[model samples]
Target: MGAPLSAWPWENLGIFKYMLYGPFVGRVMYEIFYEEEKDWKFSWCLQLLILSAVRGLVYLFWNCYTNSLFLTRNRQILKQGVDFKQIDKEWDWDNFLILQTIFASMAYYMFPFLQNLPTWNSKGVIAALIFHVGISEPLYYWVHKKFHGDYLFTNYHSLHHSSPVPQSLTAGHGTVLEHMFLSLVIGIPILGASLMGYGSISMIYGYILIFDFLRSLGHCNVEFIPHNLFETFPFMRYIMYTPTYHTLHHTEKDCNFCLFMPLFDALGNTLSSKSWELHKSYSAGNDSRVPEFVFLAHIVDITSAMHGQCCLRTFASLPFRTRFFLIPFFPFAVIGVSAMWLWSKTFLFSFYYLRDRLHQTWVVPRCGFMYFLPFATEGINKHIEQAILTADKIGVKVISLAALNKNESLNGGGKLFVDKHPNLRVRVVHGNTLTAAVILDEIPKDATEVFLTGATSKLGRAIALYLCQKKVKVLMLTLSTERFEKVQKEAPLEYQSYLVQVTKYQAAQHCKTWIVGKWITPREQNWAPRGTHFHQFVVPPIFAFRRDCTYGDLAAMRLPKDVEGLGCCEYTMDRGVVHACHAGGIVHMLEGWTHHEVGAIDVDRIDVVWKAAMKHDLRPLSSGSTIKAN
Candidate 1:
């Protein structure tokens, strides 16, 4: 009977009320000290410090909570897969705390110098905020530009740039000099306003809280700003900055230098080129429940001899449509070919689920072989389109065109696919970039001359151009002299001296390094010299047996490891290698790069592939002395 059930002990003591109105505790203390006739300046100073400390504590807790919420809420869009509980070794929290304390003390020391104590009223508070923002933007921009100078950047500013993936806590994580500069940038505006008699103690504390919140928001990895808000009010984008804008400053390093507002960046022309597109695309909160998955689609022709023969024998009794329907039931037929009638068709063969440790997700690579031959351009195009449609049904993120697929779909280097298949979310890549990279990297440094077959083809043309740039003597072999001369005329003026167009295979024998650009028959392999290093770039790789001869493939050299189903010629040194085109799809999946990487290879992309391979500890499978087909 001491207390009713509705009136709890904690409520009767007013603990809940005190907690709810904790910020007003400073006001209560100020009033109590005023009654005692304490020194007004000392009492005001104590109240200001208390209020500032309370706001700072509240912001810190709010930052932690909001960051956790955003990370959990938009896990898929952020896609960092980082554990917030695990502190990074690079974060110097001890130094951060010490520097913050020093800045706080400095701000407190400077407080007495200001003539006007800040007014606690709403109008004064609003006026002070406007002044603070107006002054801080330009001051921060110039100081930031100075910090980016060579001397300061190398010694101090580079510490902040170390975080490629930033978080809320990283907002102030930098060297002592950097932190001092940043604190000055935040502090000067408030001090200037107070000196002008526009700011009050409450205004100073309020501005600091808002400043910290905005800075924290900029550093947060999650893009929380609604894109439609900017669309509705275009000027709002100038007034506010998104997380992507700040992230671009870290990744690109040359743009988006403003602190809170993008006004300075727009004036300086320092905004990122892709900032608006990224903001619009990524700002919509992501589905957190969707588990990350990568898909790779490959094509294998059903017209190939090994698979075609088996397919014909198996489907001898079945009708055309019957064979098509039964194709999925027969695993061997699916892997190889269906029938001669369906040779113009493409079918998805094998599917792989590999754990990509880098992305912390499952990467699925599917092999879909087209039934059309290399030279069958019209038929190959029809099958390629069908293969893409089938891949779309499976919901593959990316489909890599291999060999003949590349040859048919080389219109603007797969840009045609992108234009034609807008509804299909799957991205098409030629996978030729890394193929060229592997070929270039493997060529013997001292070799003066290299033989390039099918020089008019896209891959061959790219290689020919790259080799010409390197000043290596290139023997360009093509079936048609007209096509050869056309390519020669198109070659750069400087490259003319190094390039030699040849019609015969005998001309290639003189060159020690042979690049097989087209599918070589058994007779064609014997044309190269005994000691020649044949770098095969074609699928279903062809090999020559000669005394002390070396055989390697462009695809084999770039593979992180020897995959079981990869097409390798019957040779010891280059066994267990997959097609370069197939490897390209796997590379895209493992790295989780969702873009069109088509046409001529980018040399930079090879470095990316090499780094990913090393990070994942991927290695070539054991190569036996004798080759065995999978």
Candidate 2:
């Protein structure tokens, strides 16, 4: 924009291109006169032409209004960190022109472009609308199928989804060749029907306008469909739409096609059967692989929490020996739970809160007015609980410790303070007040297990160094694979290195993780055991074992695959629990957890806890594995 308008590409051609569409449409209208009604004089034809032009112009203006903020994003804001890459491609006006010409031609000549027959009768208008759907929809559906086949999607349909955040104006702003091809794909059927005295051309105009309006509405960021409509008239769901449904299409979810009706999509197998309930996940690691077996993992981030399908599939697939059916049926095992809960309360008075239905509290959140209510509540609270547990174990005053400055770190007297177990009796200080001596304050008096978020700040680095010098157990938390690499690269190189480093060393080590972005602790791990939402509140389990945890050992692993042991990662730490991204958390369990760490994890100066056994350590409660407090 700093350059003069003369340097701008295509600034001159825009006016010329705009003028070209007028004559092109005009010629098409002139041919339509042959099908004009006898009652419709030249004056009427002129009126129709003017009306169409006005309607098209009005539609275009509406898109302009909605996108008034479009030009603002063009300005650079400071320096760019990560370019979203939505606008990197070069634009070619000529290619767009060619496409427009093709779509317009197919829409006009190949399809029945005139519907003057409807000007004479009332039913003619209604019949014309029905006839348009009967013809074009089927034809478009089949052709669209071709565009989605293997090897075709990346080169073809991908261009349209480049803008994941499609604004209202982005409607139909794709290659014109696509438009022309579709026109022939659609219009020819109408043309054939019209020649057979079965179709009216005016319907074609109505269909295009309706398609554009509804499609644009679907692309809007706001939710137009009232919740009451979806809940009350379930049958009418396919009638109107909610924003969540359409916006997901602009993302990497490849298989969702069909704009007008879901019929083609349903038959095409492109519709995500999991869309309804796929958003209730609470993972701490980055290995979200979207498991093919359950497909439930995909929903964890969405709302796909339903376990019904898994149960059915497991029941059908598992043999008696493998106990695969036991996998999915776990969610439903709570059947006799209430009865036992009542008995325990009435007689033994154990698990009293659970047995007494009136006082029973659920760790899992329940639904309220909105659908995602329970999920949102649980997700928020679960993270917070982890934060609190981590803080408590780190040995700090739960009340005094607060979140740290994102750009900096916090320390507590020669030891990085954490609010892990909640029994601390100390005051928290501002980041500016922190120093190396303040960090090493009081060596936990005489505590055992040490914990640390390794990638904290310089203050954290000082505290960690002091702790290491003292020979206290050092628990390091490393986050974000990219930053992990920066430190890892500068780290004493273990040569045998070539591209980045030129030498070799016999004894060297580097950080095990490689996540993206900064390692966040407080905001991510809600220090509170539970978080409250506008409608509901939630409390998540903190023990390594979970109650009602559907995936057994997977309950501890983030984005865990199935119960199957996929073998060890580079961390040399393979447990059903410690995947590479989350191995830092296993520091607390290091006391007796060596057996579970399948990979050759560096166990130096570590003491992993050992428990989960059928004999003594771990016992099964209805909820999950449990080890009683000493």
Which of the numbered candidates is closest to the native, going by highest TM-score?
1
Give the per-residue lDDT digits (tens) of candidate 2, residues 46-80: 43344445444444444333322112111111111
Q: Candidate 1: where is the Cα deviation over 4 Å?
A: 1-78, 83-86, 90-119, 286-630
Give candidate 1's whole-model lDDT: 0.57
Candidate 2 segments whose C-alpha is farther than 4 A from its true place: 1-12, 22-121, 128-135, 185-193, 196-202, 239-242, 274-630
**lDDT score, candidate 1, position 493:** 88
Cα misplacement distance, residue 71 of candidate 1 (Å)? 6.3
Give each model a TM-score: 0.40, 0.34
Q: State the lDDT at 65 in candidate 2.
A: 33
**Candidate 1, 223-264: lDDT as tens digits:** 778899999999988889988778888777878889888889
